[model samples]
Target chain A: MKTIKDIAALAKVSIGTVDRVIHNRSGVSKKTKERIEKIIQEHGFQINKTARILALNKKYNIAVLMPTVESSSDFWYLPKKGIEKASEEFEMHRISVNYFHFDPLNLNSFKDVFDKLLENSFNAVLLAPIFLNEAKERLIYLDQRKIPYVFINAELEGANNISYIGQHSFDSGALAAKLMSLLINTEDDILIVKVRRDNVHHSTIEDRISGFKSYFNTRKTPIQIHEVILPKIKDQETINTLLHKKLTNHQIKGLFIPSSKVSVVANYVEEHKLKHLKLIGYDLNEENVHLIKNETIDFLIDQDAFFQGYEGTKTLFNFIINNVVPPKNRYLPIKLLTKENVKYL
Target chain B: MKTIKDIAALAKVSIGTVDRVIHNRSGVSKKTKERIEKIIQEHGFQINKTARILALNKKYNIAVLMPTVESSSDFWYLPKKGIEKASEEFEMHRISVNYFHFDPLNLNSFKDVFDKLLENSFNAVLLAPIFLNEAKERLIYLDQRKIPYVFINAELEGANNISYIGQHSFDSGALAAKLMSLLINTEDDILIVKVRRDNVHHSTIEDRISGFKSYFNTRKTPIQIHEVILPKIKDQETINTLLHKKLTNHQIKGLFIPSSKVSVVANYVEEHKLKHLKLIGYDLNEENVHLIKNETIDFLIDQDAFFQGYEGTKTLFNFIINNVVPPKNRYLPIKLLTKENVKYL
Candidate 1:
């Protein structure tokens, strides 16, 4: 029930000084700011976010930089839907989002999109740092320009981002391994399928593989694990031959696909009428969901990419408008989906 | 960019009428409201929620009615934490929540709490309709009094509640059964344990058992299933005797506890040194979580009771302030947790 005036009076500071401290404005000295904050905390004083937003009446522009939906196996499409939903909700507050797409394969395309985004004076940015080196440089420039950004779906190490909303790739991979272990016997060997494509986000996939291996390492009786890297997923005959070779050579009972391109291998399994082979993969894309429904895929570790984009945008806006500091890493729940539980999710 | 005045002029209605329609006030005619809404939708006109809330400047009192945290195996404790979180967040908006607790053992206690809540002038209500018949009568009374209520943790059939935010009991059980099937061989039999206590929430437990049975029924190789109803969980000797008899009489490789009181059976298993038996149960309570961490419990079907309480409270507040109509049944994701994924969750 305490007001700003009460906080200022208690702290022996001017109302303007208290206001600056409340808004996280950098005018007040550290000592004065601490005193005012102490009083506010002691009294449980709340800054009226609704009134503050109404008073500012400022329009904010947010730039979204990520690969196009068509750029990476339609995985970005789910997050795009989530972004649009957030856009519709936040539009009431005069917040507008402009999207910039880059091709995941081409470094030139990534650079061009970053440059185009830099041309605009945006209040904030939400991006997936898929191209590590290029994204790091762009992020430094953004920091110099004093524009806050949120990283979605991908994290760039040591970047000055307000928040990174995504999954813990390594933990998710470990979770997938746990589920896979439950499906197959200890003696039965497992295959880790890496469906290669141009511009594949390698760090996430590699972390997942590491996590999967870590889980098995902890087990008393370590199961035999094999890896098969397919050069390109588009060629059906080539994929069939590669997978056929692995299955025949080893007593493989389960397939663990580390990326959203799980449908490619799922299609191979279905076409070859491979029975009793438990398939576990990532994402809940249209094709992945269909494969899961038909029992081609047994378990899926959903990163909830939709929530990453949606929460990333919302977090950026809250920081810009309300001076709310978000957690540096907002690791979403590693959701495990089967056909029975998929419908509810 | 369309203003209220523009909407008013375009709808051929007065600005006051348009305002009333937007606020869902009863004074505006249905036809006029629809016409104004049509124009607003066509132009994608957004009503600034922040400005409207600031303008209203009304303090809302929400009444939360549920069993005490100590009632029924400490399952309500998780949701209580979630409710407190929502309370802290919404306190900034002059929205206050008052909690009313009832003893789960006594129906009279539930009636007494409802009566006490009815005396207060609450803008909204959030409750768990654990006592079905009693809740139905109270819900009818609330409908007559025109106070919106959100159901959390439990649902009443055919009630005029604004939203029911919780897990689908049947589906969660089915999901649990799927996990159990993966853990044990098809030839191995399973035991369903029901820990009995006074004022047990029978509906949820029954639905879960039905869901578990349904899953096995769908399988081509039907596994033998047995049920054990422990009269009370306090006496370790009694629990040990009953479980010993079942395990000795059958080829049981898995134990499915259909309630939050899974720790009782988990403790029995640990004490008896029953190895290679998969223990799958419900909830993320302190004891269950501890059991899972030590590898005593294999899999947990998390209802996410925290989210249920959190979303239930938020939904009620949005309905009261922003006139947001929530989906009647907000079925949360049936989350499966193990030692590997439990930390991340």
Candidate 2:
């Protein structure tokens, strides 16, 4: 709340002299300017910038890196819509978002797009890391240039990042485990099915699995846990072989599919008349919604994809326009969706 | 996005005439004013009121009504803090909240405070309804007068109100039952313990029970349910007798208490070494938190009372100042809380 006049009084200078020091104008003496600057910094006197913003009408371009929406899973579509909403809201403020999507299933597809993005003069970026190691290495240049970047959906640990807006995957995974523990019987074995159709175990998904295991191990729950991995869901032979091997081998009571591709598993469950088993999945995409409504899937842990996208874009815009640093890691609330609450969320 | 000049052009008048009409000045003829007003309404053109707001700088009073935070169960305290936060955030915008507390255990106490609130000239109100029928009846007058009101924790159904921001109790109950169905055995009896220390069968509680039963009945889940209603949880003989009878009577494997006073039952379970029973309760108070961490309680459905309070005050302020109509029923997301994710929410 300290005004320029207050700073000038503390520094024993005129308001005009303080203004010269603030704007780095030539009229003030070097000694007086230094004294006024010291006073301004000491008092944390932030001049109201609304007027200055109008005077210096600036346009900021932010790049958004995400995955192409897949029909098998349109989970990324919600976040895309969120980004669009934020972009439209901030349009009058002279901020524009340039979306650069990559193939979520292909590592080289992600690298190729990020490589092209490095050539642009964008103010900041919000990204979802698909190829983890390479994406972190490529983003090192942004850190060196002090161009702030935010992560959405997928977070990179022990990296130079401005902010992360997504669910805490490990905690979310643990939550899924807690849900699984609630519904599964001790006599029945639980399966941790990795529908690795993308041929990638993203860190977020890995952390979720780790967290899920930690929850069960910590409490020493007596239920048996089994693991199975399937190739790309589109590969009929692979899906059939994996499903047959797992389903025929064990008297599975519950299945935990950590990715949004739970819809794929839900399909197989319905087709095979495996209605006795309890199922916990993720995200609330159209396919998941239908399966959940029919009771093929019991509970879903929603990552709040729309909010993640909005906050990611909003955070980057804040840093570029207002120089405000968002919370380092903003963990979105983990929402458990059931037959009754699914429609509301 | 329409301007005064646009209205003036359409009305065949000068900008001054339009301005005068907008400000309700006497210089303009009534016919000209009527023409200009129609033009403004047709276009959804809003006058620039920032200058008028500063020129008229008026203070607004918002009344907050809720149960007093009980020393034993501080459930109401979270909402109180949220209201305080929203009040502080809007202080510079010329808004203040005047709290009217009531003993939640007594119906007459609520009537007394509401009667006192009715005498005040407050611009708006945000309330947590207790003794539902009476509260709704008293609030009808506010609706007739067009003084907007928002409901926070407990919502009124089939009422004249601006907005209701709270968790959907029935859906939340169904969610709890879903969780309970997951953890409880087919042969085990589930106890619906009504720790009615408050001596009110709040509709919120009844709705949650409905939702719980609906989930079990629809799914045809084989768990048997038992109900126990206690007038006062603090009465030692009653608590002891009920606990003894329920603990001894059936093959009880899980207990469901749809209130924040879950701590009362949790304490009994811990003291009597009834750790095998899977329990699903509500809220994230200190005692329930400890029980969850120590593995005595299985899961706690978070109502997010803080967000409910903040949104209630904020929504009323928006309507009073900006004339924004909030969603009629804003159901806060239901969160399934565990030891791992409790710290984050």
Candidate 3:
């Protein structure tokens, strides 16, 4: 309940002198600053946060660059909702966010939108870095300019990011393997599917598969494993033809699709009536949710994309607003959702 | 950046008159209030929250009632840490908490603590309702006084609470069942262990066990489950003797301990070197964490008991400060932790 005036009077200093000391302005003598601070600390005078924020002379602009929402996956909804919730919480602090959406599939679109963002004077950045190599290069430029950035969902390797708020991606892959081991039959081969266009953002996929393979080796399980990377641009029949041949040759007990686009395989299994195959995938998109509800996908690891964006923005905001840096690598707990619990979500 | 002075000037009213209208005080005339509100809205004005909170001359006290921390299980740390964190966050809001810890195994200790909490003039309560029947009786008196209370960790049957923030314990048990179905062999029997005394919190135990049993029945898994309840006061020798007999008599492949005292089983398993039995239990307690690290326990379901207390307290604080009522049952996510990822915590 003690004000700055009370502390100034107690310390036998002028109110303006006390204010200078409290705000760490250079004008105050070191002796006067120490005297004023002693009284302030003793009195436990908490600076009114609202007044402090209101007194801030300038507004903060945070640039959020992420993939645009499309029919491909509902993963975009998670971070969008997280950012929306944070905006409402941080509105009073003169913090505002400008959203810049980009096409996940097209590198040119990512560049165009990202270039537009750097032109504006933003205090910080929150991005997915789906276009990994370009983002890594840009991150160094951002570092030179002293603009803090955070990674959401996908943590690019060896970036100077303030923090990476997402799943421990490699462990999530091992968890998929753990779930797969439980759901499959003995002597049934496990399939690791990578549904992507090319080597763009390939490290993330590789880390996951490597982790999955290592788990089986650690357990010394004698299950045969098959690796398949289908072309992201393939036509339906071509995809079906390749999948049909794989399924025909191997006793595919359980399938592990280590990406958000699990719908592509969900379509293949359901269409072909591959009742023998148990499936494990990621994300909670509409198509995946539909498939899980129909009992097509056995288990969906919820990456909690919502909390990634929400916590990521909070970390950046805390640093900008309070000089409080959050943990550099904030790992989210991996959650497993089955048919029974998926309905409640 | 429009201030009250600017809005008051634009509205052609005194600053005090504008203040009355902004605070929704009774002194302002309806026509004058409407005229002032119109100008305030048009100017995009926000009420200074620091000034508003400063105007509140009273302090709020929230009574937190839960089980006392014992060396047997470090489960109490979760909610205590959560509540402590929330207290730090709400420290500026003039809100404080007083903890009342009770013994889980002793009903008399629970009653002694419950009676002591009622004497304080706390505006709100956050509780676990561990001693169910006695709590139900005491809640009527609390309701008559019109004090809002939120439940944490355990939601007793038919209690009128402001909100409940914890896991759907039943579904968590079912999830345990699903995991067990995957880990156990074709002929391996499952063991459900309840480490407690005298049914002090029996309903919670029964609900979890029933849910676990029903999952196997629904899935038509030909896995027979055996239930055992051990005395809380039994000597180490007695516990070892009983456990030795149980394990020796049955082909127990997987053990499910729904409570935080998975240490009882973990101790027996490690000491006996029961390599064949896989274990699943709850919390991130030191004992559980140690066990999980050594691969003594296979899986630990993280109920995030910290968030239960923290979110539950925030809900009560929001209702008291802002008249905002949160959801009645706020379910925390069921997190599955294995040996590979337990190191991160």
Candidate of highest DockQ = 1
The sequence of per-residue lDDT tens digits that candidate 2 reaches over residues A1-345 is 468779878988888887655543467776786677566656666555885486338878898889887563588998988888888887877887888888776678888899888878787889998568879888987766656789988889876577899999998998888777767765778888886545565777788889899988998878778888876777866787787788885678889998888887888889889888788889988889999998899888888899999888888776666544466689988877878677776
Candidate 2 iRMSD in angstroms: 2.0
Binned by DockQ into CAPRI classes (incorrect, acceptable, medium, high), candidate 3 is incorrect
Ranking by lDDT: 1, 2, 3
Q: Return the TM-score for chain B, candidate 1.
A: 0.79
The weakest ten consecutive residues by lDDT in model 1 chain B span B195-204
Which pairs of residues collide in model 1?
none
- Estimate candidate 1's alpha-carbon lDDT, on a 0 to 1 scale: 0.82
Worst 10 residues of 3 chain B by lDDT: B319-328
lDDT of 3 by residue, A1-345 (tens): 477778777988888887665543457776776677667656756555776666465589999999887543567887888988987898877888999998765677888888888888888899988777778777766777778889888778777676788877788788788778878866789888877654466555666787788889988888989977777534778778778878886678888988877778889999989878899888898889999989899888887788887888888886667544455588876777787567555
Task: Provide per-model DockQ scores.
Answer: 0.54, 0.42, 0.22
TM-scores, all models, native as reference = 0.74, 0.79, 0.77
Ranking by TM-score: 2, 3, 1
Error of 2 at A32 (Å): 31
What TM value does model 2 have?
A: 0.79
- Candidate 2: deviation at residue A203, Å? 1.5
